[model samples]
Target: MTDTHPELDDLVLPFSVEPLEARGRITRLGPLVDRILERHAYPPQVARLVGEMVVLAVLLGTSLKFEGRFQLQTRTDGAVDMLVVDFEAPDRVRAYARFDAERLGELAADASPAALLGRGHLALTIDQGSDMSRYQGIVALEGQSIEDAAHQYFLQSEQIPTRIRIAVGETLAGARHTWRAGGVMVQFLPSSPERQRQADLPPGDAPEGATAHVVDEDDAWVEARSLVETVEDHELLDPTLTSETLLYRLFHERGVRVFEAQTVIERCRCSRERIVGMLRQFSPEERRSMVGDDGRIGITCEFCSTHYQVEPAEVGVED
Candidate 1:
């Protein structure tokens, strides 16, 4: 039966399947994604890539138990060279993409993410304020989709069995079309250590004919992954479907329990004070050189496209 629950957006729904020994998160973005894309006006293909990164950021960022920042960044050799998404825990997000417009236009309409991104590395970073240490993980992106890169990060860096599905597209609302994104991530976390055992990484200098060690897959995790694989792209981005309805469709048989949904918003960290402080660091001559014809220093934020006009004297620059 279809869930008639009210459709909501811009929130992460945490859930668990106890019987399957798996837990996961579900997120759907509406205005939150639209605002981010519309502000920058990225090309369609580039916008799609940005959308994917935003969803992935939300999936990983919301897991932080303390106040912190989670950042996802990519530096590549493809048409779309760089992309960044920042999520501030309890609930704020902002994202932007940098691409070679001419190069992006030359690509075919059906270009895959691997084609758009070319070769580079994806980095995920977590910062628990200045007093604490930061953690970061990097994965090479050699002709792979963002989803594929994520899977590799877990297998190599996290050493956990994980599955992820992300979807992004435009939905018609009245006469206008706006961007929307949805993603689901599942990770196996069994109580028994034996159930979480995975094969050891191959040695860098193994004998040419040596036998490789192997580990059997856990039955419960296999079933859980198969279920997540069955989710369709349309189902995820459908405007009428609530996250609750989607989770039910995926794990109703084994039973899924959803916790309180955490709301997410599109908020930029840039502020007038922050901008002023940064400007003060430049040398007096350098600060004077930034003044425009209007007699004020003009600055624009790359993430939110907010323009700032500063007086020459504001940052200790002489007229």
Candidate 2:
């Protein structure tokens, strides 16, 4: 919270407001974001949207209590067909997007999220590893932006009151231009035992222990939501503002507490070994069908652009 590592560019700070009984996460991405976007060389509009997804993924991933990987994916039928953000436990993140370059270039500079990705759903998946089954939750993409969609997912799937604000853009430093992103998320903690029981139950189902249950529209929740609304895009994207300082300015009256910051970096898990393992799944004849005129099987990782080449003998193909 104090910016202990000034050299670090991307990081997430987890915090809470004890008096309000709420927890939240704050994230900022600077050089790391630039590296990710530059690798893909996406159009301006697509880059901004992808940056928002990356920030949101880090915020939500860091808040989880899992040991494996967390992924946020969007599938649509607009100019951009797919956006994927992957967060590996402790501190690694990478993202990529697939879009029609010519169509994206034709769109206005200030295109809305819905206009860029039309008629689809946002899905959040958590992989706890081979021993455990994965969990996934999905919601319709019915918001003005990615933040709004995430808010709807929590309310609909988890029955939680959530607030999210995200900002992504390019900033000029000296002669170089780079991408930066920042976001803050807050969720209310239920006060009543009945409400807590209801949270665990599926939507529309009655809680076993709760005889009477009502939606929470308390003054505290309203006040907290109001305070979050005051946050502006500049404040979130400002490089000068530290996470602790920002939290103090936002909720000093209600009392805010900060936790240790987790460092985030650009990392890709693609390798020749993993690619070879995937190729082994196909039979010898099937593998031969994928060979190019160059007499080698080639694969390129979309996230990092790493290329892998395999020989005919590698997949048990006879000469």
Candidate 3:
């Protein structure tokens, strides 16, 4: 399929290669990522990690068919210890990172994700709002990129044959350079149960001579996985390359078909009214304690850095 639309950014395009019984989505983020990172003013490596998180969140979040939220968070012992990226269903995303500046400064400039994140847990949560139950899956982060952690999530939780490739970098336009990110995720979804069979994980406790259960991978999935693995980092991050063209390059032989693309924007769900409501939940004394020397309570949103000030009296406190 050819994309006639002009080069666009921050959109998720879903596609399928029927011949291989595979389905997947590709996301390209330019201004959306730049806006998120600039708001935080993160260092080079920290910004790159946040950018990668945004790309991964979009790849998984766009898969939701309902109005919900998909959040990717990490708590680790590495220099860049914590990352939080939120994708509200349909098209809004926001992200932030917390790190120890001194620790990060001690690492090599080209530190790997494993090196930056150290050892911790990565969590993916799906929130369906107040009426439904929230679902969360967590996997250990033992020296792996966000891509590797995602693969682990699916392997341990979903049991699906999945492949994910993500890229993040700076692209120069005129004299200014800006952050850009892109990712592609492909999964094998065969119709027949036999074709979907996978080897069972080894038993933790068993006879010493017992062999582990093993099953051969489906050939169609193997072909699809190989093609996806062949994708290079540049292809995903190139500003001039439309996602359609990239997908074509990867699976043109297998005949890929694309669905209508979903657009994503950098937006935070914070507002003065929401902040005020949260303040009201606090006791009058607690709300009063938040007042600054100016005699007004102050709050700043972590995601967007928007500041809100409220008079103590407004929340049932006598100023």
TM-score list, all predictions: 0.96, 0.90, 0.96
lDDT, model 2, position 222: 70
Q: Least accurate stretch of 10 residues (summed lDDT) in model 3? A: 1-10
The weakest ten consecutive residues by lDDT in model 1 span 1-10
Number of clashes recorded per candidate: 0, 0, 0
Return the lDDT, model 2, position 271: 84
Over 4 Å off, model 3: 1-7
* Each prediction's RMSD to truth: 1.9, 4.5, 2.4
lDDT, candidate 3, 88-201, per-residue tens: 998999999999999999999999989999999999999999999999999999998899999999988899999999999997766988888999999999988789888887
Model 1 lDDT at residue 82: 98
Q: Of the candidates numbered 1 and 2, which has the greater TM-score value? A: 1
- The Cα local distance difference test for each model comes to 0.92, 0.84, 0.91
Local accuracy of candidate 2 as per-residue lDDT tens digits, 1-319: 3333345358888888888777888887888899999898888899999999999999988877868999999998888979999999877898999998777777778888888998789899999899999999997875358988888788777878888889998877669887888899888786664533323334466667756545556566677777877888887777878878888998999899999888899999888888998999998789989888998898899999999999978877666
TM-score of 2: 0.90
The top-ranked prediction according to lDDT is 1
